[model samples]
Target: MGIKALISKPFAAFTISKMNKWKYNAVAAQEKVLQNLINTAANTQFGKDHQFSKIKSHQDFIQHVPINDYEDIKPYVEKVVKGEADILWPGKPLYFAKTSGTTSGVKYIPISKESMPEHIKAARNALLCYIYETGKTDFLDGKLIFLQGSPVMDKKAGISFGRLSGIVANHVPKYLQKNRLPSYDVNCIDDWETKVDAIVEETLNEDMRLISGIPPWCQMYFDRLLAKTGKQKIKDIFPNFKLFVYGGVNYEPYRAKLEESLGFKIDSIETYPASEGFIAFQDSQKEKSLLLLADAGIFYEFIPTDEFFNEKPSRLNLGEIELGKNYAIVMSTNAGLWAYSLGDTIKFVSKNPYKLLVTGRIKHYISAFGEHVIGEEVEHALLTVAKQENVEITEFTVAPQVNPQKGEMPYHEWFIEFVNPPKNLKEFAVKVDEALQQKNIYYKDLISGKVLQPLIIRSLKAASFINLMRTEGKLGGQNKVPRLANDRILADKLEQYIIEK
Candidate 1:
């Protein structure tokens, strides 16, 4: 066996065995996880405020600490940002993951010393689980390239601040660093366009066996690599490449283009990591759904999406969740977040192993006309249209055009950037509209009753999304086009580049 196999095999086996045990007894495992989290933070300010010490069961904990979003929790996070001790966690946070804020310019999420290791461990186990299930260790023998954010973190108030991906990249274990591509100096480049060029230049000839990044940026890397080498496919340059690990956005829309670029079918793994914590990952080689990390130092609660905006919504624990229900995920993590709403919605697909598919964001949707179009429905419609028309879409976003100045009703406007334009744009738009109507009954009724006009399709100029991302100041890792918006804020901003078809 190779050195890589020698190092990974035993650990992979152990992880799979433990994961299997936890899978069957997820409820019991989660209960223990919650108790441990409560005990660990019982003396902290947040814990005391929430009466964590007095809480003994899930019922008591839920009643004590109400569910909260970023806005609701920002005050406590602000205390941590000001270098206050024991505000959220026991001591000051090790670092703050700077992400785009919902109401403010930026959000500083705490990363305590106790929680940082869980983030790293969950990430490591994601790969180990893949290896354990697939018996694919040869890829580990070659260099792995992770297209992450700039590793140069800025320090503020004695705490480091940067993207979660960058923070993780900066802390890559010494052993793995030897097999990781793109030297640290190149990774430190802050400008994304320049950094991608440097990455292309540095790893052009390396034995790249794996690549991991969000889909759009990774597509940029592959496009540049192909352009530089004058190659038909990526496999032409890196024959050993075997895997692609991706997260942050749905990979279905970009799958065709990604596979085309690679020139061969390769195993792909998906992970659900956020500034809050690493939540879940694809555990089985045969399944697309992600297995929830029940024992990964984070306690999970689910609130039905339909009632999440209600005055008082019911929350379900791991034991109470039913299959095929959409829920807004609430987490109480080792990072000291209590009943925190991550804002993302997910639907459970399997019950025994607790596998789920991320549906969309809570605030990201179109309900301007009472049609209630969601991100999942939009993605499914787009995917259906793309398949029917044999076109490849690079990026897309939807917004409700609420005010029609002319003698017409308001409609859902779709701005699409296509890599391969459809043979007939009008037909493609009709098919997309029909597919959406089929998926959502309310949307169908609205269209049939003429309460809402037919969906409008406005083709975007090639690479227009890149300009859009630049204008929005979210140009790189972990940032993506917001798929659906309730208002015309993003649509009006992108109107200048729309091809008036």
Candidate 2:
């Protein structure tokens, strides 16, 4: 082992032990976190406005604070943006994570001095847990690359603002600084394609051991690496590339194609992170579940996804959540967000140690008909059939086709970009349709009752999704194509990329 591995092993063990303490006492940990947040923010303007001093229990909290979306907090956020102090939290925010918003145009999420360390700590502890589980800390010695957004920060009234991934880039630990790939100058490049080309050039000949990013962007990086070096598999270019750290999207749909490009299977770690907070990470190699970060400076709540839009949805605390049921995640954090809805859906996989899987975005689902298929269901259906048929899916999305030709039933249109096209498109579509039907009984009923026709597969040429993303200026960073959509907004754009065959 290299000196780095030697140093990290003991530290990894220590961190895992400390983290396990929270796992065993998850409920108490959250209670303490909520209390701390209340006490710390008791003097802030929001605290005063909400009668924070009188709130003592979760019930009290619920009575005083209704769940808030970004618009609900925008007025206070505007105050912070104008350099106001003690408006939301204790003081002015340390940074603003700027994200593209729908109605608001751009959302500037606050990251307080007290909350920033939790993000770094959660990321570090995730790696530590991986090392402790597999005893493979040697990756730390070689070059590591995180295919991320630019590290450039735009200052507003003395506070830095940038993509959350880019902001995290600025906080890399000193120990790994020398080993991290893609020089600062390259990372600062604005355009995705240009930045990717620069990353390929920098890491083409380096001893890269670990690659990290959203799977699609990482796929884009691998494509660039292959084109630059004319190598068939990524392993040919970086033999030591053993670990893949990915977040933001489920990897099952991308697994077959990604491994085909890699030339072999490799271990991976999935993380559940957002601008709101770093929520969870895969703590074990044996299971896909991500251990929730109860002690990570955030208190969490859940409302059953079906009831999310209800006038008075039942908000259940962490200990009250049951396994395998989809719930919309809500959070209150040291960042000054109180009873804030994350707009993400998650299902708990294990209650003992508090492990969960991100099921979908609360708003990103196909319910045009009564068949409300979610991100997890669609991914599972497509991935299962792809693996069985020996087909490789490069990218795919499902949108409701409520409008159809005369005398034809409406259907769900699946736009797929395939590496290995199925030999019989009709047969392949039937299998995928059946798989989805099995997962969603509502879809099955619609099909059997002749309410809708089976799904249609519109296979597209290679790089179709990539080109669309590029055209839309979302080709990289945290951006990803949605798995399911209720409307044809994205489907209409995808039509132009369809392969005529």
Candidate 3:
């Protein structure tokens, strides 16, 4: 809007266009790179195979390499830990990134030391894209406050590539590292609480210009900051702050609260962080969901949502995919993961391949009945119903509960917390029922007596639910009661608190 910004608009636009083009080109080149890696991994016997076998096409590779889970790679991880060079990939094994495995408490994911450069490049590209889109290169000089894991190392720990955060911290410039705040370094294998006191101390050292981390953890950190400094407005504490980069979960549900507490329209960016890799970022001006980093060190394979959880998946390539359709993401990464399911779903916003929006987690879905309900669907439904009834649902959740009285159809019990309570509560409930029925045909037919119509709108105080979670031992800053519930156990627990009150 300024004279300088107006004059410089075209240059910024050009940079964005060029960066987007570069990403598109990278997507197009994925097949060749993937083939090369597959061949090289096979030739060098990275995991189990030994022989540079030919993979002429995408189909050939998929057909030959069986789809594998973490369990399949456990042996290779063991080998790498024993200093078995080139066991996972044809390079020195970097340190392992620890991930919360489903069964195993923690699993160390392996990465090639050579691939570290790729991670840096991908991260830089995200920054460059952000700069181009926001047209805010002036903030580049400001101190960035990355709300990342603490950079503590175990005395006997050797440099491993699996803990993604540790790898990043290890690679940051030593000069910048020295100036980093006195926080509990928890990137190493250590209890997080051990360093909490130290982290609180470090946060007071300087005014952070940029804040980056998972939304929950960042919120928790700020809550701690509030306690430490007796401050409410984060901007007052860190007056120079320009951006708040968050990811690892959807921020929409908590955005209003965060903005209110911060006291500024903080520029926000979302990132895709995983044990396998830092996959994508939010770079668009309007869209809030993360854009797939197509040009990053991973070649993507998308399995249709219906086909994703199947034992035998029908995977689609970039050339074969469509927009708005949900797909489970699989990637061949520089970290030596081939056709690995990333446990996330994404939809393409544009055909550019490099740009995508993460929809939700694969595991987080509630289809108790025939009505398939995902987090996005639930969020959209809540907004729609609230709009129709002229109310704002500040907090809500849907759960399937059994109606043992025999004749009634099972209902989706909703617990809603509204900023402005609706006077026409019955009409509000009807509107919500109508919204659900219209959006999902299964629910519509069910409402027509084919099955049970969903019950909507049981209101409760917001703090009551928060207090319940606290009682359940998930307290303090980060813990949030899940927005959707499928089973009766968690649903019953939530119902007991909100149903009566």
Top model number, lDDT: 2
Instruction: Give the per-residue lDDT digits (tens) of candidate 1, residues 317-359.
Output: 9889888888999999888888999989999899888899999
Task: Compose the digit string of candidate 2's lDDT tens values, residues 1-501.
Answer: 888889999999899889888898999999999999999999999999999999898889999999999999999999999899998899899999999886779999999988888888988988899999899987998999998888899988889999999999999999889999889999999998999998988888899999999998898888888888889999998898889999999998888878988999999999988998999999999999999999988999999999999999999999899999999999999999999999899999898899999999998999888889898888888889888999988899989988887868999999999999999888999999999999999999999999999999999988999889889988888898988888899999999988873
TM-score computed on alpha carbons, candidate 2: 0.99
Q: Per-prediction count of colliding residue pairs?
A: 0, 0, 17
Instruction: lDDT winner between 1 and 2, please give it.
Output: 2
Can you give the lDDT of residue 225 in candidate 3?
Answer: 74
What candidate 1 gets wrong by more than 4 Å, as runs, is: none
Q: Which candidate do you rate higher for TM-score, 1 or 2? A: 2
Tens digits of per-residue lDDT, candidate 3, 174-229, equal 43453344432433324334344456676666757667676655665666677788
The global Cα lDDT (0 to 1) of model 3 is 0.65
Choose 1 or 3, whichever is better by lDDT.
1
**Rank ordering of all candidates by TM-score, starting from the highest:** 2, 1, 3
Each model's C-alpha lDDT?
A: 0.89, 0.91, 0.65
TM-score pick, better of 1 and 3: 1
